[model samples]
Target: MIKTPSLREHIPKTFADIPETTAYEAGYLVTKNAGWRNVRPVIDKDKCIGCLQCYLYCPEGVIAKDGGKVKIDYDFCKGCGICKKMCKPDAIRMEAEKH
Candidate 1:
């Protein structure tokens, strides 16, 4: 039902400066907001065990350690649920977005 461009279309036979490939083509860092996901991660302080698993596995780098507790940054989180599944202590849970 979906169609994607071919790999050859994205890569060139020779090296040259292309405008379309400029974004992250040469190991550059880019930050973009991904807060449009349908769900979000919420951390429970009481249930957290301070293992830091969620922080290490977060793909968006939205999880962090505050003193000894884990905190989630909703602005950049894409709600992929990697943190929720990686949290062995069951501290993080994925809930539907309020809006």
Candidate 2:
């Protein structure tokens, strides 16, 4: 009879011991290359009320307070969609980044 490995035995002891990339990682790379574009937060100046809500909620620090309105740094943004979700005025919208 075949036996399945226990969950405890399947986990790695240390982070370094784990493989550099897993199958999921490879799949993500494939999807990313195949136009699985990331979402970037775009702030509509007219809709934005200069509340800094997006800047405060962005965990990635991609949102910055510029003068009074908020601006997103697309280069560092991971497209987590948090900023858009947290916007009180719905000023932020997630748009697909062009590759």
Minimum summed lDDT over a 10-residue window in model 2 is located at: 21-30
| Candidate 2 Cα errors over 4 Å, as ranges | 1-37
Question: lDDT per prediction?
Answer: 0.70, 0.64
Q: How close is candidate 2 to the true structure, as a TM-score?
A: 0.59
**Per-model TM against the reference:** 0.65, 0.59
Worst 10 residues of 1 by lDDT: 18-27
- What local lDDT score does residue 25 receive in model 2, on the 0 to 100 scale? 25
lDDT of 1 by residue, 1-99 (tens): 899999878874432322222122222335556647899888889999877777777776666556567677666778999988998889888889877
Best by TM-score: 1
- lDDT per residue (tens digit) for residues 26-69 in model 2: 22332232234377778889898876666667775556555556
Off by over 4 Å in 1: 1-32
